[model samples]
Target: MSPASPTATSAIADGVTDDALKGLRRWNLGLTVLHAAQAVAILVLGNGFAIAVTSTFPEGPPGADAPAPSSLFEVSISVAIAVFLFLAAADHLVTATVGRGLYESDLRGGINRFRWAEYSISATIMIVLIGFYFGITDITAVVAVIGANVAMILFGWLQERVNPPGRTSTTMLPFWFGTVAGLAPWVAIVINLAGSDGAPGFVIGIFASLGLFFSTFAVNQWLQYRQVGPWKSYAFGEKTYLVLSLVAKSALAWQIFGGSLAG
Candidate 1:
């Protein structure tokens, strides 16, 4: 539903007035309703399937047949869209319900742990599911990729904290590191694709498409820090984020449905 970089750096003079903040908060609340509706529709209309898994741990003699892998937890891949969509809705719901003072303070500081936290889980899950279709089925590889995605998001959180507005315009180590971390999973996914004979064209399209969408979140933060034209307005960047979330999530949901989940 979202990507790296919680909010714009304070250095950008968006003149985020209280009225503007209130308006944006309402937008996020409205997003909650829309995302919730999509989640429900996905669950009601789509047939679900389990993502295969594997792991090794202390075990007794194998049964006459191959041992079933221990379940870290089971979730349906067919309805995966609903899962992340629900999570995104919950993130916005909390933002809307929370005290305005805290939300404004966090935004001003260039930190929104709520956004990163949800992205860490929601986006990671979506990517992992995508990787599965790429033939990245080894549990260790999957877990490692998941860790990389989560790390990328944590660095995005750090980007906000360490580089609060008015700080020296020196190097932004966290943002750069986060961007690299974001690349790791796609690299793994590509490797999976390479090993296979080939994959569906639409499947490859999913990879390229989502890769571009997620990349833009980092771009958004870069613009905020650079204080370039148009982006010089933090309000502009904020509005862009809402629009981005809507488009990116919808693109992903429909892409998955058309390419893999739909019969």
Candidate 2:
């Protein structure tokens, strides 16, 4: 049998490389959109919150016990933001399922399922936020929101463990750390919502939790760079992860924590 010519071999290699790069580009695009959507949703929500606060209590007496805004227009805006956020989360879930090849295999299927769960939790958080605009202070709603937040962190940890991005070892540090960071705000929210006179402590907890979350990503990125040399070697979604970590998480942390502190 004659061996393959150099031209044919090179052509086959090029085709395979092109296909792989195309797949990477697709994943990168999907993740970029998803991260951008989440960031936008957070910004919109923050804007609505700001509008409600200004319209309601423009003078003073800002705190957890501050009177709920009564302007129909402001409330409607907040509701709209919540709806948009929910839709974004839903869209990302669908895109992730397809782009990430969730159904391509059993392992992929599990990861995709976890991602869907996270997306659903995000949607539920938006719904609860909408209820806040409607002046729904039911303890159950607050608890549900906290529960969903915790669940999302758990799912994130599991996803990282099941499928470590690029080449990383599976460790429980992220899971434990995320649990502590994610739960801090929930605890604070629960305390405030439960009618406790602990607004200051609650505010502190929220701020610290946000700081912790942001710091975790920063540290992770540093570690990755230390180990992986540079951004070029990073995985397809790494850029999105870094951008979202800073943009989305910081926007959320600052908006809620800063607003509460100012109040």
Candidate 3:
């Protein structure tokens, strides 16, 4: 089905919210399918780089030469990271576009500045991650990761600086969520810096981080969808923002950590 248009749900959201959701859903089916296809391709191509006959990996430096973990385990891990990178790209594009497109569509809430900041920082992080993945894994990765963290710290400050009246209740969740999500990339970078052998520490840290993120999200979503009191009572904008942020962070953590392991 075609995605819903801007006005389709206008009655529900203040004009601004409706406009944002509409723009987000704009290329819904096509964008989602394309994203999925891209993810699959990256995984397949990435796997091909492996010297080991048992699995796939993208061609690259001796990074791939690192001794294999259990073949199944390594392949599975590689596939997970490839998927993470692709989705991070997709989410960054979609969220930023939605935030902007809403302004273009009739809901200009003094939010463009915030959206721009969010988009810019996110894109920068992705770029750094991309660069690091391609062979610049030493000090350069450290620098990029540090830069990304600084941007996010600034983002948290900017959020409060620009907070608008009436929306505080709703915006708090998303604001914090975004803040935390932005920090997730650094967690992987730090783990990488410590060392790499796909040691149990790295593997456990990656999975544990993911589990914590998703568990929070699933609980939030369940509460919201079930119309539970806690969900309804927590404040509207807050829950939505947090729910979205948690999911994004979990995915981001997965991708970066996966890439580190795969490489």
Best by lDDT: 1
**What TM-score would every model get versus the actual structure?**
0.84, 0.31, 0.31
Per-residue lDDT tens digits of candidate 3, residues 187-211? 6644554565554554445445544
Q: Cα lDDT for residue 200, model 1?
A: 90
Query: Whole-model lDDT, candidate 1?
Result: 0.76
- In terms of lDDT, model 2 sits at 0.42
lDDT of 3: 0.43
TM-score of 3: 0.31
lDDT of each: 0.76, 0.42, 0.43
**Model 1 clash tally, residue pairs:** 1
**Shift of residue 133 alpha carbon in model 2, Å:** 7.3
RMSD of each: 5.5, 15.6, 15.6
Instruction: Give the per-residue lDDT digits (tens) of candidate 2, residues 28-124.
Output: 4565465556556555544434323223444565554656545433333334343434454444445445644532222221122333454345534
Clashing pairs in 3: 46-57, 46-58, 47-56, 47-57, 48-57, 49-57, 170-237, 174-241
Better of 1 and 2 by lDDT: 1
